[model samples]
Target: MKSILDTVARWLPGTPEIAMVLGSGLGAVVDEFTDLSVLPMSDIPGFPTISVSGHAGNILFGACSGKNVLAFQGRIHMYEGHSWTEASLPAHIAAECGARILLSTNAAGGINPLLDPGDLMLIRDLVVPFPLPRRWYVPDSPAPVARTGFTGFLIDQKLADDARDVAAESGLPLRQGTYAFVSGPTYETRAEIRFLRRSGADAVGMSTLPEILTARKCGLRTIAVSAITNVASTVPEILTHEDVKDQARLLLPRFSRLLREIISNL
Candidate 1:
């Protein structure tokens, strides 16, 4: 099968400044865009199928606050048996389509005590369980550097600062913290939740890491946000994906507004 990069390249809709990934129930943000064009992910020749609920599984081209955007209304995941490259395909496509920034959003279980359902947490950094490939350092740099002792922030802080200004100006509450990425079709156990909180994760989710890493590798400045959909507690409280999606739905209008304004200024 031909790569969808070629397909997207041929029919690219706009010169988008940013590429946005809408995660889980977060996909509805594209509805706020003007001059929107929609393409189902299934229609992209080599694109993978989406099995998760609440993901609309489409690519959206539109303008948010007058800035042209290429937004993916859904995303692939490593938990879905996709490779790291496959999970991050949207990020790669966004760069190929001429986007300079990547803005990604997801629904996560709050790992921090102060965070609650319905809060929007800015991803200041990420914590993953294992090593990532060393080949990603921005585009057109020297050869991909070997993994050194570079224990710096992987997610861009400048972009995070931009979002902070936007949130403050909008009078919307925002939480800034670290996000933990895990491969899962299951929720975390109490021990797992404890481990993550200890490791500095304020929110936990199954997606976003691969996408963020890929976006950075392609020279796209990246910003990630999470809709804290539930609290991953030390107590074994039963939670469902449906519950997570419901909370994200409730957060949509407010989250959408904040995200739109941030995109305008970026």
Candidate 2:
């Protein structure tokens, strides 16, 4: 895997200081970058393909707000039937490519009372349920279990403040929250949503944590934002993926602008 990333890095013209992962409908943010060169995941050796809708399934190299950056237009999720290690390849590759900072975005159901649909929430912490592999989980066990736990890095306060300022300047609402990652091809049931709220989760989603853990392990400073796509715990209706997609589309422009401002300021 390291060899493959090395080969890919050789194909890249320069080292990027920042790496961005586009989540859900947020892929449009890559359009704001200049001098972009896109490489499809299928074309990159050892890169996992994204099977879900709203992900662009490619990597874009360009300048975002004066920073040399590499942006992934999509990401693999645990719900896609991929192992945690497989889903985290992008972060590992990004680290190997010399990015010191990792930025990620995702659309999630808002569980925090103060959040609303279309609001952006900065991830200050993550609470993960599964363990990530560490070569092997137990002595004498032939198969290695993935390592998993709380990722210790917090988002840089200056960056979070800058993101908040950007949201305010753009008239987009911004909030802070604990992002919850669930293994899912399905939306959470109402009872599950209630349980998450009781567990103190502020937002809920199907992706982000594994990538965050992987990024921190590879020595990159990580920051993540969530676009609130639905009100999970309070909504009376059952949720569907289509609902997330529709709301994400409605929120893309503002979300894109907020990301642009944050990246520019960084």
Candidate 3:
């Protein structure tokens, strides 16, 4: 991991203040960058390639709203036949690249009644029922402490606040709620969605948890935003991967605007 980090470090134009992981069909956000340099994830040792359609599988370094940013156009997932290390590598690389703020985005099914397809939800917290990988790291603080393990992490408060303010100014209705993660290659059944909502999940998705946990271990402040791609059986509609990608198109304009403003504010 250290050697791979060193290799990638030599390619960066400057230390990135903010890092982003884009999910599903949301890779269009990278197009908003200026002076961009893109490296395929396959070229980066220890980084896994993305097989999913909407994921571009590249690391992008560019300027957004006058802020230097690093972005992962796609992310690997545990459900994609990968282990913990494969899925969590992006967060580790972001920290080594000197990004203090990690912003992750995903396309999810809305469980909250008021949320419909194309709505944006800023994650307040998350619920992941499966066992999470344990990661250890030493911090760079003046009084550095020994390497410590992380558990039960939450999104960074100031980052989330910035997202809320951006949403308000853009005239986008932002929903704040807890996200639920499941190990999935299959879409959740109606019964499963019902159970998740009963347990206080406002939105549900497969990715994000491992990356979020990994970010915490590296001492990076993190925040996640979800684009509600479907209502998750709350309505009579059947779900399909095609439908998720289609809905993400509807989300692009607002999601891009919110992200642009957040970068400017930061």
Q: Which candidate achieves the best TM-score against the true structure?
A: 1
Rate residue 223 of model 2 by lDDT. Answer: 80
| Backbone atom clashes (below 3 Å) for every candidate | 0, 8, 0
Task: After superposing candidate 1 on the true structure, give the runs of residues whose Cα lies further than 4 Å from its correct spot.
Answer: 130-151, 234-236
Query: Which 10 residues in a row give candidate 2 its minimum summed lDDT?
Result: 136-145
**How far out, in Å, is residue 206 in model 1?**
0.4
lDDT of each: 0.82, 0.78, 0.83
Q: What TM-score fits each model?
A: 0.91, 0.87, 0.89
lDDT of 1 by residue, 1-266 (tens): 24788877776777888899998888878877898888888888878888899988988888898889998888887566656667788888888889999998999999899998899999998887534334333343222113323345668899899899989998989999999887687898888888888888899998887778767777888899999999887435688889989999999999998898788789
Q: What lDDT does model 3 reach?
A: 0.83
Worst 10 residues of 1 by lDDT: 140-149
Clashes of 3: 0
Candidate 2 lDDT over residue span 42-63, tens digit each? 8877666688888878888999
Model 3 per-residue lDDT tens digits across residues 163-222: 898779878789999998887878888888888889899999989876787788789999
Model 1's TM-score against the true structure: 0.91
Model 3 lDDT-worst window of ten: 136-145
